[model samples]
Target: MSTTTGLWLFRRLWKPAEGTPVKAVVVFLHGYGEYIDRYDAAASVFARSGIVFWGFDFEGHGRSDGERGFVTEAGFDAFTDDAEQALRLAARQFPGLPIFVMGHSLGGLVAVRLGARLAKAAEAVDAEAGAPLFGRIKGFLLSAPAIEVDPAVAQPHLVFIARVLGSCMPRIRLGGIPAGDLSNNATVNDHYSRDSMNNTRPFAARFASGVLAATEAVPGIAADFTWPLLGMQDEGDKTTVPGACERFVHTCGSPDAAFKLLRGRKHELFMADGYEDLITGTIMPWIEERCETAEPEAGGAAAAEAGLARDGMSGDRDDEAEPTDVDAVKTTTSEEPVLGAAV
Candidate 1:
């Protein structure tokens, strides 16, 4: 699918199993320097579970048209606007299905803001409008969201210098993330290095500045978040700050929010070893439970309860450790052996 939101953005949808009825729509937001294809494995899981999965390349990444890694127009707003366009497309393609927005890394930051905006919009009365533009959003799923940049990439003086340079040369490429830091699986790392659509090139100065600003602003809006949220982060992740994810989940106003800190996983949790079953054990069940309900207004208690049960909290485990916030839980697991084939 393509949308003409100022610039054309490329998107694709993964339908549910042939004989299955579509129960809900999930809009996936890929991480920075990555594209929609990275989530194909997870999409299949969602599809088989009777949910429609769709995602798009952010303006300058993947198959989308734009200068690589650069937010050429509207600054950071361009990304959020692109997300809205994706939501509109989802609504048009499968009207009335409860929509869930899922984001990873930088996309996670976008999802947080998008979810908050939609939740707020659902409450206002529009005299001339038939329905709110974002009334269908039911929840959010975030994986290692870039609410705060890793310290290695967020040096104050350097970021300040980059911001200054961006003002004059917004399109100048700065530097890109190391592929090794993305995952523990060698095959996944090699695949990312070889994928042409993956933006391995250095980020444009303006794009870096925009991302920094957006990430910094996410925590401030946590008070406004009021939808069911499931956030997962790998403690071993070097690509984004895990502490920030923990803080966001704890502080966010959503009564149904739950955070899981995977012990030996990396930035891309869905692509990590044992991730397939992890989704079956956690994410899939969460979505299915909510989709089965006609109205999600009362979903908070049920979602939280279901999440706790799936994490095996019902029974004691020696590897489990609790975070500072009672709401956030930490579970430690031995690293899963790397697969011989690429994810």
Candidate 2:
């Protein structure tokens, strides 16, 4: 059973299905323009693991009070605050339970920053009271985080131009434009349109400002983060460039940061076929190990120890706990359509 509670004008929950215990909350963050409902299937998986799931609608997103597809400059910051409030409220509802934060795409970036902020805030409280401020989270899960701007195309100039132009014309409604303004393509997939969870309109001035703020802030989060972090990036990801994902894996400051490129998978790894099984069978087990057994290694411990280490990271062992050959996924050809399918 799951019960919903209101926090910051949004709904959150403690979902305990599939025999999950009363404790063990997993806070989920949906991607841009998307709502928590898209994660219903994922929540069920957590329930089966005896883990309660919690998630909410960002202000400009589902079920929250705000203009549809319109975001303000304080967008990301507000979302982060809402998430933190949800965590505190959840703690009150179910005390003494271990919590994990997981985010997808834009949400992934949010989780990384939020986790580090929580730690820092707690430190601030400890300095004054000589006691930890909040229950430390168990771990972090980032699936295809939208950390780096995609490099497949000439992005910097495009982004800069958009920012500059948007400043002059802040109220532009890009949703009706072909290829949705960002790509300028004609056949931008309909899934984005039908999935009301996503924000179909153009980025509001405030929201755009928040994105720049987030991008600038990512380095600080990466440098300060001290929790176990797992990143699952796709080799064939179309939304975020492979180059960016690779850089993020090494740049994230967590000693335990590890990203595996699912060979055949697309940007949305969670929604991909068979991924639920892979997560239940592989990733979750590793997260459990960190939560129950040891502190996550920082500065390239997990990757170096896993023997799959690459890109300037080096370690002597490959003790990553995985059934041999289970991590392999299929690869895609250059000719395949990148945006049409979900997976």
Give lDDT tens digits, candidate 1, residues 1-343.
4434466666766676455666787889989888876676667667766677777778888766787888865788778878877887777866678888998988998988887777667667663462534556668888888888767768889899889878998888888888876765667787788877788999899998898888778877898887878888887788888677878877888766667667666787777766766666668777776667643221111111111122211101112222221125322234321111112
Report how far off residue 316 is in candidate 2 (Å). 42
Listed per candidate, the RMSD to the true structure in angstroms reads 10.7, 13.1
Best by TM-score: 1
- Candidates in order, TM-scores: namely 0.82, 0.72
**Model 2 lDDT, full chain set:** 0.56
After superposing candidate 2, which stretches have Cα over 4 Å from the reference?
Answer: 1-8, 127-134, 151-157, 165-168, 174-192, 293-343
What does the lDDT read for residue 99 in candidate 1? Answer: 84
Candidate 2 least-lDDT 10 residues:
298-307
**Which segments of candidate 1 are over 4 A away from where they belong?**
1-5, 126-135, 295-343
**Full-model lDDT for every candidate:** 0.71, 0.56
Error of 2 at 27 (Å): 0.2
